[model samples]
Target: MSVRAQLFAASLSALSLLTATGALAQQGGLDPAKLGLNANENLRALAGSSNTAMVFDNRYEGIKGTPYAIPRWLPAKLALTSNIPVASVLLKYDVYKQRLLIRDPSRPDSLLLDANKVTGFALTDPSAPDVATGQPRVRQFRRFAEAPVATQKAEFVEVLYEGKYSLLRRYAKEMEKADYKGAYSTDQRFDELTDKSIYYLRSPEGAVAPVKLNLKALQAAAPSLAPALKAEGSKRPLKTAEDAASLLRAAEGQ
Candidate 1:
């Protein structure tokens, strides 16, 4: 057999093995506890795709911090370009590479999902608890065309407050390299991932412009809520993402 044909056959074989475990995945996503698949095998299958898999491995080996926005995998619902939505996937957003990572119960390596296939995704916040519901908060993100903004089309923008006037956030991560001057010197040993997010306000007509995290910019983008924002700012701080979302809720009389 030809080399190309052999490679194609190998890819198909690996994928078929993964499909064998699809029954477990259908029983409400790939639960961590029920995973019987091997981690190495899973990663090999994920990387088996030719020119279709999302980028793999960290650019910097042995880096101190992870490339993901949050290191932990959270339950996510994926909206695919094919219009078929996939749910119950444990996902991680790699802010550095601007790609999504999927977790397998038995695998140490995450499956780099093909970004071209996914239009957007919704992730339940693992860290933040909703004060109103006393449960974990959920955040939604959409890609370039779905959530048009003045940035890379492949980038995912967080819909912090979706309304007539919407609020969006784009995460930009920078790697702070190791600063080890000498063995005797007291300096850091590992590179860290740092956040430098950019915020935006979308007009009712869907025009998006970058804005500051402060109230003035937000209120300027949402003039109707200016008075309410001013009043609330006086009572407390309008300096946080929570504050901004709260004011937006207040503006809508929610």
Candidate 2:
């Protein structure tokens, strides 16, 4: 063969070898066996195993699975359970003897038990106009008198509010049974049912000012309950007398 032809054949062979090597590299050149990774390490390569374990633990070992979790809290919150619209707000005394049945309009079979009773405060018909709206038909809490309802949703959407209150009442009853004082109080400060005496008017800067209450008289009547009454009175302004009167009853004969 001529030297030029021989050189051409050698070049063609080298090109073929290079093409074959590139094809092999693309195919499976990165074998794990060559990399010294064992089967156990390979198993650890699977995604979400740790995440799955965390989820499993959270599901079974957390607040969701405890006895107090499902029936006491969940039943009252979920839509599938007893759902009723709040026809009206009632005080603990008003609800004490009365059997307030919360029936699910969707499921007649599902009715909530013992939802009406309330303590520490109650909702009453305003004896006079709201200082703001000057309308008696509007509802409000005697205590925490800023606005009868905490959120606008609780005011307009009766069912949602009622459902929330139902759950709250359930929790409250549990607390009362367990003697949890904090349960009766709330960060909200104002709710549908509140002691009238414990209310105050909201100042321009959002400070609480006690409504028209003869503190001297309340103090004279019951010295021990005075501090509690005063604290309660200061939470929200009882813009009206009816609100104050409800609170006054607690101090009577003190």
Q: How much is the lDDT of residue 111 in candidate 1?
A: 89
- State the lDDT of candidate 2 residue by residue for 52-92, as single tens digits: 55432221221111121112111122121134433432222
Top-scoring candidate (lDDT): 1
lDDT of 1 at 75: 91
Question: For model 1, how does the per-residue alpha-carbon lDDT over 1-254 read when each residue is reduced to its tens digit?
Answer: 99999988877977777776776578758875556546465785666556665765343344665777667889998899899755578999898988888988788788889988888888898589886897898888887453444457688878888877777888888988766565674466667888888878777877788888787887787787789777776766777877787777767667
- Model 1 stretches astray by more than 4 angstroms: 1-62, 146-151, 178-189
Return the lDDT, model 1, position 236.
61
Best by TM-score: 1
In Å, residue 97's CA in model 2 sits off its true spot by: 27
Q: Which ten residues in a row have the lowest lDDT in candidate 2?
A: 158-167
